[model samples]
Target: MLYNRASLTNEELIKLYKQMLLPRLIEEKMLILLRQGKISKWFSGIGQEAISVGVTSALTHDEYILPMHRNLGVFTTREIPLYRLFSQWQGKANGFTKGRDRSFHFGTQEYKIVGMISHLGPQLGIADGIALANKLRKDKKACAVFTGDGGTSEGDFHEALNVASVWNLPVLFCVENNGYGLSTPTSEQYNCEHIADRGIGYGMESHIIDGNNILEVYTKVSELAESIRENPRPILLEFKTFRMRGHEEASGTKYVPDQLMEEWAVKDPIDNYRNFLIEEKILTPEEDEKFKDEFKNTIQEHLNATFEEAPITSSIENELNDVYKISSPTTIAPNSTTQNIRLIDAISEGLRQSMERYDDLVVMGQDVAEYGGVFKITEGFIEAFGKDRVRNTPICESAIVSLAYGLVVNGMKAVMEMQFADFVSTGFNPIVNLLAKSHYRWNQEADVVIRMPCGAGVGAGPFHSQTNEAWFTKTPGLKVIYPAFPYDAKGLLTAAINDLNPVLFFEHKGLYRSTYQEVPTDYYTLPLGKASLLKEGNEVTIISFGAAVHWALETLEQVSVSADLIDLRSLQPLDTETIYNSVKKTGKVIILQEDSLFGSVSSDISSLIMENCFEYLDAPVKRVASIETPIPFAGNLEKEYLPKNRFKEELLQLIAY
Candidate 1:
């Protein structure tokens, strides 16, 4: 009752047989490599080869595929060289990730494939964004993202599916229900009758098929893919299959019953398909045996050469190379015009100008459409750019951040705004793990600017009020920008959008209306890693950023102390030249930060000054920062907790010392 072999031509039937046979041979050779001590680990798809081969063969090569670690057949079907696969498994320097990552954790832009992280479900949202980009470009291409039955339990799966369904994006969410998630069975994971049925709640077209039936899988998924390309919509496909071996070679078969293994052994997809091919007269018995022998020999050759190749040699110094791309400062004309603007207006104007300059720029966040965001920063953007460009996403922080990688990798720049900086915790994995390490691993550009509305004084409480720049300062490959003045906010943000790296732009909610400055009317940019010298003095150098800069400036005015004030616009790439020069002039240094005192950016700066300018110090570096507790809800408690007055006290004490 499945797809009939009589419905296909002899050539099509032969191609299907070869596709299924190749991954099976590849997995077998991989196991041999594991025993020979060439590969450290192997996550094989022995029983699930039909699903990978069928699904990949259904789609065109131009359409993108975001595959999991077990889906090596997708790479093989894409015609990736056998040498690269063997090299990657052998940990040779010629692998796709240059031996930086093992197994299937490598992809190239030329192939339109983005490899998976250890966390599986985030790629669903990334595929959603790629589909969105295709829609923007009016391309009739769809993307397919794969995951296992256990991955459905992740929150990213639900968020991505919901968004794809809502926007009618061309994404195919495939769940290879292999009966078990590691050691746990399906009954323990979900209560649903079938994983495919869950798609109905999201209003997506759903299908469930026998995964071992290659003809059925190829026919159904190919039709569904064509439908998705013609009219953009998500399709949830669940393939019911089982893993023949244990989770890994090291895992014994004690967990799987002998009776279950026997049942699947009789129904082996390769054996059944070969018999079908003979019955249908597609190939003679001798021809089929010769075909398989040829593939086995080819795989053996690649495996043999892979062992002869040199193992990847790397050092700690190699890791320090590609954290950030070297980008020059933006050039501004000498006669550029200026206009007075508020801090928030300057930020909004910068977003507008960047969008005008780049055709592929998208501005997205929660309540950012007609509602103009919670802070009204994007009030009129929807009218100007339309709903497609100015998107209003749901309150799913992880998906919002995950989509940025998908957009940027597909020839687009994204400006993502978090409703509040405190909510960034929900999306921390992709931000720190994936986006930050993208360029370092594969030399891909993550051109994204994540706008974070941070800080206290608005009585928004802990959930809404937070300055989380410290959390990202330790992460490599991310540029952190926290501007105090309106001019710097506009200039820095503009430069961040244009730069070829991931940037976290922190804008304080308190400074949105309080700060005012004459910003440029047209376009201009300030260089990153360059600190602004606000007030020059010879006694002590006070280094700060964001709202803390204003507090330090106010304290300096009231104390009448001759102290050098430095506002660090960019935190990650610290302005060592400016800080060292100022330390030479003023022998004393005081670091003031508004965040919690423990593990603060101020602590990092203080340590840097101590290590680099130890001789220039007249006294040990002093740090004045917030108390080590949550920002309080009450107005009086919040004021006492922040204690901006402490800056003046700390400054006066340091001067006396």
Candidate 2:
């Protein structure tokens, strides 16, 4: 099949030819560097440069773009330094990643280019989020995200498409179909011939174009981008191209046929566009040669200047720099005043007070506004704060978290809720990449609180029942908190809201309705990174958190042994002073948790005790936790699987030691 060359302008045809030539030359030089071992690895968008440059040139610079790893042409056309790009490929600090991020993760905030998160389809959800923020701010900016045909198979892709359509977000999903995902062909991956067919299921408009034709790519992308900006709807585009080389430097095209390679080489986009330019009389042979020489010299000068300068180096001290904006220590004093309040009431009141104090705070999630959330944690918030401040989002976990990250980045304090802790994994990419590492990567504080209901005791079963604190405790730049009673819940949440970093507020499903010590009616806050001593004893120290604290307290009363009960409020910053002091007083220690034993918080606590308080201990630290298996659906098995009588038995053994 052939396309007519009479429709396009001569200058536009010549420009497309020049763009393709530069990227091809740049990739050839990179392949040479890779072969010589000057660069460790490289991924080239060799045969698919037309789609990248054409689409990027069509969009406005003020708009946001989330390009994938194979988008060097887009970045180059956007005026990202070629030298910096090469330096990044060589793992130098002079690259945009500051010597920390990989080559594909390049981005500059000044260019309105949101960084490319390496995760496959998760960036699609985040692109919708950026568009959502722009809409909320009344800014006329659209978001464009690039992904491969192989990525459409991921659940996140479908999830993001659904949400973008539902919310009418100004986002464009570009699918660059380069024929293969590494060695696997598209025929083996999906039954559908084109990825654009899947977009129909989500009620989105889609297009399929010849990816090798720069004129076609540019014309289609320009129209779709403008249409999305005007109507604020999502668009899905499928660009059909071929992979001329291996997927990456490590992969070889041994399985590919020589005939197929020769066939694609004959239809090279750059050569085709060059012929179109000559047919249109855009340039003579002498003029074309001059243009090629000028571009090569300009690129060489940029590369020379970039490589000659000193590169940024990584250091151990830099790791400690961006966790939080550490200001001069401000003294905080706890109020002695007290009043009675219920657990649920305390949570609602704390949110009210925080919202009243900070105008930047915005709360959103599934059923958070109109229905007041599933657990009623956000009850009466919409009526009190108005719709702009309190929003109800569709049941899209990944989109909800990604939108929260966008809001926080734009100087808004965001509080998002996961319907249940088990669903948090759906949004794990943005939570780990954007929220957890925002400050660490760009020295930007992300004030976001993710409220999730966790723990199993009310028969939520395997799907609904899960304790995920252990999953994020090991992650840097995240503060995990679990409160036992109403007072701590209110105070700790308030403190977390005030923090300039991301915090995971895990509320126990069992403790939400359980009666506990009352909280004060007046506004107050509790300092984070501190533990409460429920009971003081000398025999053994029993440390626990959240609903497990209640079990530990009950076991201490039943047994004749007097034990020290310490409630750990903050999982990330463990109260070392309080824990060590209790361990010193009692030579024996028992760590109790409701989660599985493998890689749980109990393991970290036990290791900490052995490392810091080993000399003061008489017996080895014992851990009492749920069995290392999935929570069963049956009542009897679930009861047996949970750490019930085990805590008492472990405490007794430690005390008797």
Candidate 3:
């Protein structure tokens, strides 16, 4: 069942058999290394090598490959040095990531192979973006992104597939249905009878193939890749294969049923293809044995050479080298203006001014170019900047973030917008692994701006409303900023753009149209890691950011309490100097956020203050945030769940004490 009835010539069959044997031998070597403790871990493609080799053979060497963790066969067939792979496994200096990234994260841009991202299903969106860029440049290259059957359950997979199909991008999505995702099988993951059936929802051409059949896989993928490269449409190839080993080296085969393993063993891709080759007289029994022996000897020599080389151990020093690409001498300054401004306009004007100042700034997102985005923050950008700079992208968050990374790596300042902050999870992998840590990992700076509309209110349901600042702020090497007023927005955003590190610019949707203030026409910048003191008071220090700062200010006005209000514009590089100084001056403090109090940014600030400024505190630091529940759709329930504007009342009670 693993082989097709179509006949192949002696030479063609020989090639297929050889390719399969190479991966099989390599996998066996890796498993031996793992058992000997020479390698840290192993994620083998033993039973699935046919599909991997076939897919790689179908594409040109110049085409891009964005593979998942189970892609050893693809890399091996592409002539990736076996020693370099062994070095990576042993955590050596000559490893693909220079010992900084994991084994599966290796890639070579010179070989036209984009870096591997291990996050499930996210790479598909990135592949779409790469294909789109090729289309824009009128390049003939196509992109292939591989994943597993379980990856289809992720939201990013659907988002990417829909966009690719709609835009007709030259992308091939290959899903290797290996039956198990760790312990959860494909039957438990989806309701569809076949993985290819889900492709209909995206209006893509789908194919179901015997993943064990190398010849069939190569022919089918070659035809699809060529067709999409010419017509530029999305194609989904679902290869039904089986995993011979457990998920990883750490996982034993105890969870797998004996009967299923036995059945799959009989259909071993390597052995079956070997039999096919001998039966067709493509390879004599002696020739097959000699070929394997030679291959094994070569792999053994490479493994020894790789192990003899010293392992990479100096990753700490390398982490500091790529924080920012262009180190501008200019540091941002704090805003001294007494005039107030709204947050939304500040972001728009900040982007506008930044684009005008720098010709390399490119902005893209859903409805960002012509529709001005869902918030109309970028409404007139297309008219002023033209289509090249201000472009509208398909609703593919993963692709959007990955494209931004690619552009930034090639000397462009990419400003990407996520229609809403809640949907950022769709692109979380690219942002966290690629954007946030690319500079740290690759010794290359990724200067990109991610603008996200966040926060709750206006009766938007749980899916639409969320304040996930804590998620990004927790990640190191990334700068996070949330401006409350127009002045702060313009200043902080300008600072973020000027920063060499990746910055997450979060804008509260509530302040987009409702809150307005006078912004300066002149250029101004705010310093990173500096907090804005809205009101200086001696009684208590009320620390907040984004929309909460405005609420904190209004509360002070109503309560008539002299409170020191600190607007923490930059979340990652916390302004400890300002916070400690204020906490030292005012013994009491109140931390506030639109997110839930538990594990919120406010909680982090409270911990910082308690750890560093505990002796100076007059009372325990209090926190006020939304209830620990999903945002409700009804107005009354939402209002009850969110932080009320009764901070003044609470402040009065504290002041009376």
TM-scores for all candidates: the values are 0.98, 0.90, 0.81
Off by over 4 Å in 2: 1-18, 309-312, 320-339, 352-362, 385-396, 409-413, 433-447, 498-500, 516-525, 557-564, 632-639
In terms of TM-score, which candidate is stronger, 2 or 3? 2
Candidates' C-alpha lDDT: 0.87, 0.81, 0.80
Cα RMSD (angstroms) for every candidate in the order listed:
1.5, 3.2, 4.7
Per-candidate clash tally = 0, 0, 5
How well is each residue in 1-657 modelled by candidate 3, as lDDT tens digits? 556636556777787778878878888888887888877888878799988889988899888887877788777878888887788777787766667677777566655565666666656766776676666566776778898987888877887888778767888899999999888988799999998998888888899998988878988888888887778888888999999888887886788899999999988888887887678666789998899899999999998898789756665545555454545638545445544555677788888988998877888888887788888888899889888778788767786787776555445678889989989997888888877766656555667889989888877989888989888887877888888878778877887888878889988888877788877765678877788888888999889888888788777666667788999888877889999999999899888788988888888888999999999988888888888898998988888888865566656656665
> What ranking emerges by lDDT with the best candidate at the front?
1, 2, 3
lDDT tens digits, residues 442-513, model 2? Answer: 556667899878888888899878888998888888889999898889988888888878889988888887
Arrange candidates, best TM-score first: 1, 2, 3
Which residue pairs in candidate 3 have backbone atoms (N, alpha carbon, C) closer than 3 angstroms, thus clashing?
92-312, 93-312, 341-486, 342-486, 372-379
- What lDDT does model 1 reach? 0.87
- Cα lDDT tens digits, model 1, 413-487, are 899999899999999988998888888777787888899999998888888888989999999999999999999
Q: Could you say which candidate leads in TM-score?
A: 1
- Lowest-sum lDDT 10-residue window in model 3: 332-341
- Pairs that collide, model 2: none
